[model samples]
Target: MATSPGSDIAFASQKSMPSENLRTKKLPLSEEEVFYMNCRAVYLTVFKSSLENIISKDQLYLALQHAGRNPSQKTIDKYWTPQTAKLNFDDFCVILRKEKPTSKAELLKSFKQLDVNDDGYILHTDLYKFLTKRGEKMTPEEVNTIINLPNINADGKFDYIKFCKLYMTTSGQCLKTALERLQVDSKQRRQQFGSHMEELPARDPSSVLKPSPRILRNSDQETLSNRGDPRASLLSTARKFKASVTCTISMAANGNQNAKLTEPNLKDWPGVQSRGCFFLEDDGETVSHQYRLHMAQRSTVHLTIKPLNLSQVEGKLSPWSSVDTALYILKENEDQVDPQLVCFTDLQHREGFGWTGELTPGLYRLLPSTSGCRLRKERTPEPEEAQLVCRDDAGDLFLTQAFKAALSDVFDVIDLDGNGFLSLEEYNFFELRTSGEKCGEEAWLLCREHFDTKKNELTRQGFMDLHLMEANDREGDPCDLWVTLRAMGYNRALELKEACPFVIDLHAERCKPRLKAVRMEASRGQLEKATCQSVLLQGEARAMDGYENVLVHTRSWDFRITSVIENKSDNKVIIHINNELSKNCVNNRGLNVFAVEVAPQSSMVCQHVMPLNEHQEWVHHCVYSLISS
Candidate 1:
């Protein structure tokens, strides 16, 4: 999002925080607590494991993959399988309390065991069988959580070596802190058998993996038919079927149909902001074509990683992302980023990871990143259609010759003073027409930073760079740029669209405004070079016996006339104004010709000056007369 034709900046806290106890410092968890944390740290890694408040051996296996540390199945069997009971979340708290932190050599050896073919890759089937068939079986959902999308390729192989290398870089303390952030106290496990309740709402008991689906007998069916089973097992019971808690990650916008708009985050992150997904598009993190959602006012972004075949994700060298990628939300302004409100949703989320509170109105990019950190772009080819339009070559930015030529002509049109640089006023004039927006001073400065500029005015190169920046932010989506192109009169073929050559606007209260386009005595051509320049009260008013010539002049650009019309006729009179000469400059809902009817002996004023398009500017002299109604 290197500024979506917009900007960035991290946030500074605006609100004064209420004072708290100064002397007390929070202590870190030790032993089993830390181990339990390391297990739960696999939140997104184990698919919906966060919500259940408990984990299975299958879950532990996925967590181990994430930590790049795997223990022997014997260790698992001795410490875990002895209890033929549902595994509660608290059961693993001390699984490692007595043992030292697993060593790097042990972790490496653990990974080596799974590479049966010694091919330097861990196959998905090898892991799926190892975790499910032995120790505690994990649901396929859990296994898929760790092995899906950006992590594993279509052929189902994991680069365990690369993952292990990244693991080695982090120190023991950093790893411990990352793991224990959420496991501060004893987990509020499910209230068992009506024991002294803690006055908190109860959730469904965490599903325990069944060895196999229990087949129902005829007697069992008859008994069920007599009394319908209201509650059915929600965990995987058979080899192919799973019925865990509802998958909230896949919920559509309808999930938040009553999404009320709020501005909570605005107080924390104030200043010039953008208005779309907050991703650094220049960083090569592009969304799938269909997923580039724009919210005019409000929208719920469904951020699922596109399959490798659909879109190439360059996370092979990214350790954390390839192992446990997440979609991070960050607030951006003027090239500064403030993770004002930060949260991570699993790249393979199933625990309903979503905006827990009101997502304040502003630009927020959901980056599929190694912790939502902006990285240098290692981009793939942009969207096919956009590149086709621009036809970029390697390192050429692919800006097509046609598009560049069109932009050059556009710069000349908007430059206004023949200085070869577009001033703020001139640029805003272009901006207002093409995008219906004004590029603010800060935005202009950003333009300077990214592109070529002189004396603060955007140069021709800067203008081109600005468009390229927009295209990059959109991940090669062509709609936005095309809007500007078409507005500037570029057609699909990049040819200038046909336009009406002359335009005039005026309103007179006591005078009927009449306009006409007279051919130039020389080689039929436009008169001058000023763009959208309008000088007010720049006209002469004269009275004649039969009619009046209320004249206004075009100063080489778009102009308007404002005057009053008076009627002293005994009967009603009709005066008509025609803008046929200025049709191209009229916005939608503006008419070419309008009549003003005045009552007997009364005067009528034109309601508004002629409405015209700023896209093409002009000024014209006016003459008026009356007709009997």
Candidate 2:
């Protein structure tokens, strides 16, 4: 008899089935492959070939229970709810293939792959394609902006160096990259324009990018005068005394107390154009005044004083009243003399009697309106209290200079043996005394491993190296522990109960599950029956085991699950729903499908009858529709 093709195929399969099974048994599946197979089986069993299959809460619960996989409600909501609780072929592939570059080298490799042209740069189009493949939906404008970042080349291309710098750091916002590029550009501009702007005013050292104010010169005065401005006269007069002056003055207020005076001069005064003038008066109402007033150069005048009796005056003299003195500056091309009020004062009161105004640099004369009036240059007492206050303020100088000096002091104190070296025991003692905390066993071990030798315990250099290494690992302060303690002051160090509060040890071991557990009670009956037009079912199935325990809420149809039965042989589940309301508009009996209609005011119970997997799929659809609504 001749064998058909189908029959031949079947006979061959039967003959090779045992060998295939043996081979399969010998080669165990990998964990990832096994997981994929399980997921595929669950998907096929629940959805079959239907494109619009939905997994309801109860159905999903049963499926998960059968598969022996339980996931939290939060996980389910995060991954499933946003997709309407349905898994399409694309979504299934996404869940299985989701991954990201784990290292800088891997990211750079991927970036190079995106450079399709074999050039050293990535263009805008390539970047857009790369981001799109990674499931990032970006607009053309956004892609252009990213590709045209300041760090990128002018031709809108990304180089490997800049790309690596941008992604290698934890802060990937590209701010640092932009700032670096900005600094480079600024330097380039400065170099290019430095020669052309050589005449620009120099910047002050104390401030950044600020030019010092220009001093007015004789040339400036000439320039202003050529412009026919009134300020030219003032400027000319102000600049004439910019040279040195030689003048002296003395004051004898009571004839018995005479005070010598410093030479009134403009030699040391760079911007000053005027100085105070002084005179002396006697108690017998006699006045004597002297002034070295000149228009071109310095001059001196000495006057002899004659005493006047105030009782001989025509009008009665009040004891508290004093004569008014005035000084005036002679103005050029004018008959009137401008009062140099600011330069005049009574010797007794040490203040102007009538007027006080600024006296510009010019010719001036001192005159007294009545007797017993003279200018006085009072001998100001030394400010010893002020000097003491300043000395107290100088105490803060330690804050600026104490870092190095205090470090030296601490090092000497810590070197108890005075051998210029610190043993492990000595270092520990110093640490305990300074910070109130002992070094860890691992720290000591690490120090020994790196720096310990047969002869030397730890030299100064070796100790510094070990300390720096530890500080770097723990992100601690780089300053010496003893030095930091001394800088903080003894009183402040005593106030701190714990040691090294500022140092954070990132490598220290911590308990499992670093995040704290938060208790979240499921919300029940939050939505009223009248307000709820649909039902919401949530929670885990494997959490409930093979039982039908679930959180169910309903609104329009006042229904509840009365009982649930599962058939293990056929993999079928039966859910019986009971209506709470006595009067109902729809027939509520035996629902073999997800949705059903019933006669109004009829039976108060309903049954959803379907295969176990099919029932779960139908419930998924119902839940999805409810959520979407």
Candidate 3:
């Protein structure tokens, strides 16, 4: 028989009859197995704290000695080393001081008290006393600079209000910096606390906190004596097992109280903030909005939110949640709307794709793997929407010409006759009346036949009256022809009025200053304005058409003014007229003054009354030369 080494087993027992039992009851031999065995034994003991509690170096060394590690003092210093303790002493006090002061009034009072000097200002001398009283040793110059800021009153007094404000602002800035640093340090501590430790689940379903065995053991006798219900026998047994204990035992419970405790004060880890733009479209118009959010790094994102119902979204086309749906709706309802949607993440990167389908208005969430998104209305220009009115000084070219072409198509459809002019009757086909007075049903039908389908071409003058002029019934005057021409889109209508030639025929009885009569020929453009200019030539009396005619020219701006001659029948007719600058100066290239005069009862013509400057294009010069030729 042999005894096991280092154990107190007697050699006699080894040789005894329990050999089979000893062989069956062997202990675990690995370090982990041994530690767990010791842990179990310690758990059974009356231990007052958690297994994760910090163990002192001496206690740890004692345990190591129990396991047979007997190194020298210096070696043990390296082995049983103490950690650099966390700098959290008075941490709450530090936090308290870092908090912003609540009441500004108190700070101002304190500042005023610290000012010390009865003299209105706090100077270097004043600050010395103040700092000494406060046990602070700031430089006098710094104190003086603070006290002497521009905000000091006109009397050079450092008001306590200003001083308190400045001090609060400066102190808050310093506190903010310090707190930021402290926060970073605290975050690092939290990371280190969890770094090497076994991970705890965010939630625990199996463990509950219960009273330790000591409480059961101490309460067992009393619990058994007072047990009123037979169903509480287990509770009585539990009482017998634990007494006078406040231990938080981690064990499985069937109820819902098994989860681990979490602090509500703790915040989620800060992540990156990103912004994206999105659009809402209604009818043909699209409005935009931006989405900014803080997102977890390297994590999946699930966004589901409703669109903002902005007031600017009013229109026939409602903003659809999905771009594809909106596009489909736009195409299907082309007769109703020309819908477009545009998205822009970056202005510089404008390559966009569209979806072909109709989408109804509602909220939709976009799911993307990336950090941000931007959607905006695709700014599609409808040049055809621009009014069809012609440009006077210059015709619409390039983009405008495209618009004009569309208008021309519309006009062709409206003009029924193949004639080169749009008559008043033909113009009525488009629901545009030629006169203020209502026309008959026959006139409307005739207009449709002549203008709506005939695709007739209309002259510019006829077009002006048919499309542009509005009937003006003021001062018994027929109409304002110039306004109509303007609305009709002729830029040079004024110039046209100035350039229209006029002729007048006058007849009178001989010598008695008899009643005078005169007749004039006026263009349609002139007649629109109800004005005409004519010169009366001085010559021998002749038949109504035989009066000697002298050519003279006249230009007028006010259409209302009509010139008349007196005593036209008797004596020889003498010319008395005025020369004036014609308004129809097409070549407004530079400064100019032109003159025109019309003889009495005479025909007149004046053409090309415009000034050309050095800046005028060579093309203009060529046109002028051609016209002159």
Candidate 4:
């Protein structure tokens, strides 16, 4: 080597250097590996020596730029400062790794697999099935609504690109984790419930197993140390047990039974006639109607009588009471009416019954009848006096009276300024009085927004309209009224039950359709050749008024009516269709006679029209019976 170092000797000398020795120990290093190692060595030697094992802010900026990482101002602020500019080797590696670009191929592949049809588009149904197969018990409608969002497209269809973009963000990752946990829980639930588990077509399990790069890197192993397990919570366990017990009880009660069961008669039961102050002789001529039979401090009895002939009549007795004697007559007469007409009368007095100064509510079944009809009591808890006053069969008359009464009472109480209209403050007070809580900001704003500007306040008419709209909104579902009542401090189960019926009846009066049926007959012409027009009408009278002057289209001919004549005395209406000269008749001189019979104050529309006969021999026919619309 002294004479002229041979190649082998030179190589050996080079490999023996400190840096080379480190590389030689870790043989077969990749290019990247070697580069990083050399960079680390140089960094420690030059940067650490001068900077006390830390790189300065300027040094880090230069180093990051040299390494091809364009750190933003935010990143600089997060990791670099005059006093804490130096970063340890570990911290340096972590920042670089985080900054490293991630390949979207894995996420793309997962989304492609979820798109079952391979059509490049994922529909809500497709997503639903995929999630369900993976054990997510999510509603298809909800999934559909979410997937069809505005940003994705006007049509709400999702493609692979959009899917990846949505799920790759930090917020998206959080959502994905939550959905994954939900799916897992759903799968577990299916297994526990013995429900059928839907399986997806077999494929590479690894394809679905691949997670987003961010999720994988940041995935934390949830420890029981901080939050503990939800299943271990006493309240959660109790709730589950309670739900299970309720389900079991419901199933047992719904199972087949051998004999009809009836409530036992109380000992020394009072005779039906002597039980209450209200009495009706069994003349059997009285038609079925809603009637209040008795009023007591703690109990009230309501009777729904359907007088069928004299000796045989159908009746439903609803007795709300804490006393067993109050229900004795209901039990005794349970066999007198058809089982279908019997109503539930079993009402147990629970603790929260009169908490709101309202009636107690309960549901009792009139033991199974011979006909296998078991009627349960209605769940409306109106005051007996109110029920007596509010009659469903009274048509618009009852509504007008009730509305007037309610308006007068509410106006007297809410008009603090002695003005005809209510100011915002007064309206708020009224709301508080009615619901036991002030109206929310949004509700108050809505009320003010709809105020009559001319009056500059909520007038009686405006108030009525607002309340009517609110009532209409609640008429679709009776349960909504129950929830509202509960929110107004009527939270007891009995109280809700007692109040349900009254609230339902009150709202139903407005929404209820009054049209019974429409009947028509033409007097002249080959009525058989004439086109018959029949219109099955429904809805309120005011709504149908628009159609009153309109001509009704028929298959063969058009029917024009000037107006409908209502017979208030008999609760019937006469519909006169404007007739033309009988063109089909051999003698074209006679006018066609048309007549229709309808319920009084009914919103009637032409339902059906048929030609009588081609014979033209003075034929007369009328609609025999009226059918409920």
TM, every model: 0.25, 0.18, 0.18, 0.16
**Model 2, span 126-215: residue lDDT tens:** 666754444424445444434543333457576754545432331221222222333334332232121122123444434322111211
Lowest lDDT block of 10, candidate 2: 499-508
Q: What value does the lDDT take at residue 145 in candidate 1?
A: 42
Badly placed stretches (over 4 Å) of model 4 are: 1-261, 267-400, 404-629
lDDT of each: 0.37, 0.29, 0.25, 0.30
Error of 4 at 457 (Å): 36
> Which candidate leads in lDDT?
1
Q: List model 3 lDDT by residue over 1-629, tens digit each.
A: 12224534231111122125334865445443333333322221211222332245444332222221222233234323354122121221121222213345654444555456644345545544554344323344434333333343335444655544433343333233233333334333233221111123333444322323322233322321211221121121111111110101111222123221221221342212111122122121122111112211232211122221212345532132212111000111324332222111111101111121112332221111110111222234422222334434553212234333333433443333333454444443322211223345554344344223234334533333322222211211223332222222222312111111111111111111111111111122322112112212221112222122322222211111112222223322322111112232232112121212223333323221221221232111110000000
Cα error of candidate 4 at position 227, Å = 27
List all candidate RMSDs to the true structure: 31.2, 46.3, 46.3, 36.5
True-structure Cα RMSD, model 4 = 36.5
Candidate 1 positional error at 252, Å: 70
